[model samples]
Target: MFMRKNQIKCVSKAVLVIIILLFSNELLAQNQRVNSKSNNYFWDNVQFGGGIGLGFGSGYTDISLTPSAIYNFNEYVSLGLGAQYSYVSQKNYYNSHLYGGSLIALFNPIREIQLSAELEELRVNINPNDPSLTSEQFWNTGLFLGAGYRTANVTIGVRYNILQDDNKNVYSDAFMPFVRVYF
Candidate 1:
């Protein structure tokens, strides 16, 4: 009877271990599916796009065409580079090449709508012939708030510049409407 009881206890323990392991594996699989679903909903890869825009503020008016590209490391974070050519009435109407990277964070409360905050640096060079200045190089830092809508592979957005400093003169706040294509 003593040997039989010992054998029964060992079998029971083995069965209990097997059940525990099975349950644990099932839980792990469920967690993996949930994780994958969440990752799929979030944008965690590189994105590229470009658009044209116009800026009018204070005593300055500009028509610009810009081409830009970005690498989004995750759903909430991205870095980008862009160049712009602008014709300004207040200045000598020279074209400026701008290269800057922006760090942006996105908040999406719904499937189609997203809000973002970005900090960027814009480098500008003034026309040498402008009587108001001899030679000027502008390094402007701008803070922007934007909202976007996504449809298929395209995103349409509007942004407001809350801060801008051109080193020589500061201009009034401005707004930009843009579109981006994702691949």
Candidate 2:
């Protein structure tokens, strides 16, 4: 029998991440020639992955897309850059869109756990219905530090926003979750 629509969608998303990781891993296994006589450099060691998130509350909806690429300096160290786009809609409340980029670092003492850090800069725009309050746009910055676990292809973790904005931003919560799929 056919599964429900939402179930089918979830299955497809899972398959997509797995397929991406498997395909990239196959390419990574190649030791083919980079030149006539030269070997590949450190830049040859790279992986790509990121998380997708969606949320619903009593009167609001949140959807986001985050993609990232990481380059390995060694087994224990790597650097990455990623982008985030999110839209929030609420009944009787303002609607907003958030766009941001993050610089990420990961250090793994072992194969299973990693220490992480990110510096993010975000621009948020909100449109309110009230005539007294004008539509607003502002930039906010956050520095986050946390740890996570990594398996063969997926990572799940939580982070605390160490530098939270007090007056002009909506992400006042100090903690958040992160997921990634390594390609």
Candidate 3:
């Protein structure tokens, strides 16, 4: 009788351990399945959009138009390209027609917001007879860093020019505001 009682107690303990292990495994599997489903939904619905804006600064003012498109490769990474045109005027010295293409890489630290960096090569044509010098075609390169916020289909942000160069060193230290539309 004593041996039988000991045997039954041992069997009950073993059964309880097996039941807990099975329950935990099922919970873990369900959690993984839910995460996978969310990932799939996000990736299937990537987006693309662009915008145009006007800005003014201390010695310069510009009217600019930009068109851009983006491909969201994943939740954290996106690739973009844009075309921009601007008419820029600077304090009776130079008036320029600027056009450029930009390549951008974006990292999203959170949903609906992104940190972006871009490289652009712009072709600038100085107006002739502006009392500065002869008209010339020049190339300018710009590096920009900025943060952006998006709500629905509209995006708004400001970017600081980290570096700027012209064929002639006439202008530097520019900042601009940009707006984007995603369709």
Candidate that scores best on lDDT: 2
Best-to-worst TM-score order: 2, 3, 1
Candidate 3 vs. true structure, TM-score: 0.59
Q: Which residue pairs collide in model 3, if any?
A: 50-181
Clashes of 1: 0
Write model 2 residue lDDT over 28-146, tens digit each, in one string: 66534434223356546778877788999999899999898999889999999999999998877788999999999989999999889999998999988666788989988898897
List residue ranges in candidate 1 displaced over 4 A: 1-44, 52-95, 130-133, 165-173
Q: Rank the candidates by lDDT, best first.
A: 2, 3, 1
In the range 6-37, model 3's lDDT, one tens digit per residue, is 99999999999999999999999999999999
**Ten contiguous residues minimizing lDDT sum, candidate 3:** 164-173
Cα lDDT, all candidates: 0.67, 0.85, 0.77
TM-score leader = 2
- Report clash pairs, candidate 1: none
> If scored against the real structure, what TM-score would every candidate get?
0.52, 0.74, 0.59
Task: List model 1 lDDT by residue over 1-183, tens digit each.
Answer: 999999999999999999999999999999999999878755456565666667787656767666666666555555666555556655544434444455566565565876767776767665655566565677777778889996666768988878744444324545877576656
